[model samples]
Target: MKQTNLEMTHNHLKSIVMAIAMIICIQNANAQFANSFGKQKSGKQHPVRVYFMAYDMQYPGIAIGPEYDFLYATHQKIQCNKGTRYTDKHLYFVPQFGIVKTDVQSVAAFVNIELDFKTIYQSGFIVDLFASAGYAQIFENQPADLGASSFENSLFASHGAFFPQFGIGTGYDFRREFNTPIQVNFRVLSASVDMKEFIKPGLNLGITYNL
Candidate 1:
């Protein structure tokens, strides 16, 4: 009976040790997996990007703009619909202001989300798509007496008028120098005035610097 009791204690101790070993193995595996993907930390990472662009505004002619972006979101290791894994995803809040070459002037504050299908570390070929929405001001060459309220001017900035704007675009980033990226994007901007709709399709060429 004593031998049986001794055997029971030994078995219990062995089971405990094995359980501990299994737990350690799992923890090590998780750490290794995270390290392999460069995902040791997950959540808000702050990065700022600044860029300048020249766009051909279809209706008003050409515009030159500068933008400031604040990166506000990131998701690491997201599985795509095609069964591939994306290493990083980011969202940015951007404020842009532009001058439409003597035809018009505009300013906007907006948010845009970017999904990087091919990361810089993975490939030189970049695929980035974005959508933006926000408020904007359009000032155009108008007669001084067209004197209207801010709201009216914003909605009906004729020849030279003012209004809110929304836009969507897709662009690609290519390595330009050591750490700078050159971007070429095509976008469409739209607004309404006195029940009339105006559409402007434009192409943007810019370079971005990260800080």
Candidate 2:
């Protein structure tokens, strides 16, 4: 059998990438909300929106430890659309990070992109789909049981030669207008790293504010 170079250790690079992902997802949800909500508020050169979409994760084999999250968690986005008087149909860039706060403090990083299309003005909602692909670096404390050994590269990457990760998700964004900045976004996203590794599904709650 070939020796697997892959080891289970904390990945700092993945942490940063995940943070960027969190931010982009949150912003994508918020922008759709703000654009379709109420009046576009006067005197504002740009409009920003915020939203919260419940979050969850799955990583069974690595370590089935206790799952904890910050009760007050959210993602943010900044929109600059130069279309509707330099208003709607704008472009955005988002990056995010998350901390698993409890007895143990663990962190992750992410970054992604967003685009808007189509608007429905009937049930106080915005109909647009978003797909974001990024990487996440995580850390594991040395317990010796789960095989945590010290090595040069504790972090694994998707953009590298070994394996790659591509996550895709979309759902309905509900909000009245662009100023109120409150929305309920539903997303079912999946990502796979290795052949034996399972595809992880994530649901994130995003919150944004116009800058």
Candidate 3:
């Protein structure tokens, strides 16, 4: 019975991940299709950005983490009044190391992703949508809860279980030259444990610097 429950949890998580991925793909495809009919230009660019973000989660608590993001052009460039812009596809990899400050103090690590909208060396207003999937490792100081029940133990084990996260936000770019550009954004963050069986949402204020 326990094994059956675990398998069901894994299956459900897989479905949620697949659905989110498909939505992201469809959005990108539509953007590409629209660009295909517009004026074309020659010039390719790749940009890398790093960020320091602070988040408040409804489940475990609050934490701060670092993120890395990069983008590659989609082979076709479209014209903009400023000049020309390319449909740059972005991929983000972020590892969050944080300390939960709730009644249950714990340390956790979460891996996250965010899709950014921008072009090389061009910046003004910006927006990004993000998602994350990972496990949280929790610890308690009191020894009384050591030999808890199987269900409780499994739920809050030293090595925790799966969790899924999603977020969206809008911000602005400094557009500075000969200096590092900065982005400030406000985001609505969310996550779930035991698949979508239990879910929570929160908020995040972040700052990103382009390299």
Candidate 4:
């Protein structure tokens, strides 16, 4: 049977519509498959982790503050039986502000550029090397006979000094199991308080919570 021109045009349009629908379905399926593959490759993607609260015991004194990972990057290397191992070997800028006490009580604010190396494996061990420069407002203790309160002395005798510090630390991350990411690190620090004088060696025990 010979088809009319109108019928032939209608059939061609129908075929075109069906082809478009099939393409749409294939694209949707491909997107779903890609999403599923990503989930299987990496359990949960957390691009940025925050250290909401951090405690640092700086030798003769202690400094308590918060630091977060910013400008972060990571690389996946070493394919294992389970999957690939992801490592963070990048620069992290951490800013901290808190009270510090040494020979004199002070308020410290610092920004650190850190090179951190860690593996996102079951073990979760981390190593960090950082350098920081900041200012501290030191308050010299008043004499007993001054008869001024501690707050009054701190308010009146405060002076600012710039310092540079370098430290190396190692710790373990407890995130895979607990869901609460906590890192406890022991650090060896060298700080130059006098700016031009010799650097003073110190120890630091730090705890940080990563969210």
Candidate 5:
């Protein structure tokens, strides 16, 4: 009986030891995996993400046949991101579709880039300036519903041309830059063909994710 009791105690202690060893091994493996992933992230650029922007602005200067121009319009855009946080620069090709109240078909595209003016590693709010150039084509498609259901018409602005774009924005991180995945930002963009004729100006209030 004494021998059996001793054997049981020894076995229990050995089992506890083995269990502790296994746990340690698992923890080590997890740490290594996380470290490797971090390295991979650092080496690559723009991990490839999809972003969407929903914006609303007043659509001014629309000719409604018998000399009527109005305001107040809403627009939407969906974009693919080729943006890198480390570089503090991003490029997006956005396809935008909008309606000018009741008679105009508003379609345009833009490619913009955000550049960080300050160091990305710095804490607090970082104000950045951005510039982008693209084409804005206004088209008039035959009518069915929703602003005449336009495809691409000559009455619209040139569908393809180089335009000048300029904007200013600020970026805020909740925690530190490297540790956070979600960021919030606000920016205003104006695309212009000449110095005076503006294609469009939009304000974007959106979120960004870092993978």
Candidate 6:
């Protein structure tokens, strides 16, 4: 009876020790996670970055704009079934005013509002996605012989339309090596003047200097 009691006591003590070790390990892990998160948050000295694209081509035309970083976040140690992944993300808002000159000699003035998403990898490669909506006023210059009696026949007749665009892009970040906040991107875009109609495919290549 004494031997059985001693065995029971030893087993209970062993279980208690195992539980204590598990609790200590969990506490250490939590502390390490907190420290890592704190460091990441502290490293973000600038939350908002300003950038500009002097020449942004939209296939049918060219656009120029300034963009602002609205949100920036770092997501590290994301667990997947295979392994862990780390990345940084950014969100930007861009406002642009541009001129569109088509092959048919139609001239347009447009204003656009765009939202951009960027995901940066550790190797300085970036993937981007963006969407934009714009309104344009197109002026059709007709010959004087066409007459100004009707709207369509009038010279310098102006009409308005809306264009929405979405695209995917790839870029390289120079901030890691040059210590300058510059990024160059190339994008393939598809846009529509009227969604119910046809789609216009375009390309955009630009450089952004973040300040």
lDDT leader = 6
| Clashing residue pairs in candidate 3 (N, C-alpha, C atoms within 3 angstroms) | none
Question: What's the ranking of the predictions by lDDT, best on top?
Answer: 6, 4, 3, 5, 1, 2
Clashing residue pairs in candidate 6 (N, C-alpha, C atoms within 3 angstroms): none
lDDT of 3: 0.47
> Candidate 5: where is the Cα deviation over 4 Å?
1-56, 59-104, 112-118, 141-158, 175-178, 193-196, 199-201
The C-alpha TM-scores of every prediction are 0.40, 0.41, 0.49, 0.57, 0.43, 0.60
Worst 10 residues of 2 by lDDT: 62-71
Go through the candidates in order and give each one's C-alpha lDDT: 0.37, 0.34, 0.47, 0.51, 0.38, 0.59
Candidate 4 regions off by >4 Å?
Answer: 1-60, 64-68, 80-84, 104-122, 144-154, 176-179
Model 3 clashes, total count: 0
Residue 79, candidate 5: how far off, in angstroms? 40
Evaluated against the true structure, the overall lDDT of model 5 is 0.38
TM-score of 2: 0.41
Question: How many steric clashes does model 2 contain?
Answer: 41
Candidate 6: TM-score? 0.60
145: Cα error in model 1, Å: 10
* Model 3 lDDT tens row, 1-211: 3445466456545654654555465445435533543112222221233333333454444433433332332434778897876443344444443444323444344333334333333444455667766554434343434455655433333344465667676766565333545666666766544354555566666666543
**What tens-digit string does per-residue lDDT give for candidate 5 at 1-211?**
3334345446545544554454465445435534543233223322222223332354332110000001111122334374322323222322222222212444333322222232232353546465644332333344443553233222322233344556676767544545666565666666443445555565545455554
Model 4 reaches what TM-score against the true structure?
0.57
Q: Where in model 6 is the C-alpha error above 4 Å?
A: 1-60, 75-86, 146-155, 194-198
lDDT of 2 by residue, 61-166 (tens): 1101110111111222334463222112322332222332111322233233333232333334434344434444444332332554433323332121111222
User: Between candidates 2 and 3, which one is better according to TM-score?
Assistant: 3
Candidate 5's TM-score: 0.43
lDDT of 5 at 123: 53
lDDT of 6: 0.59
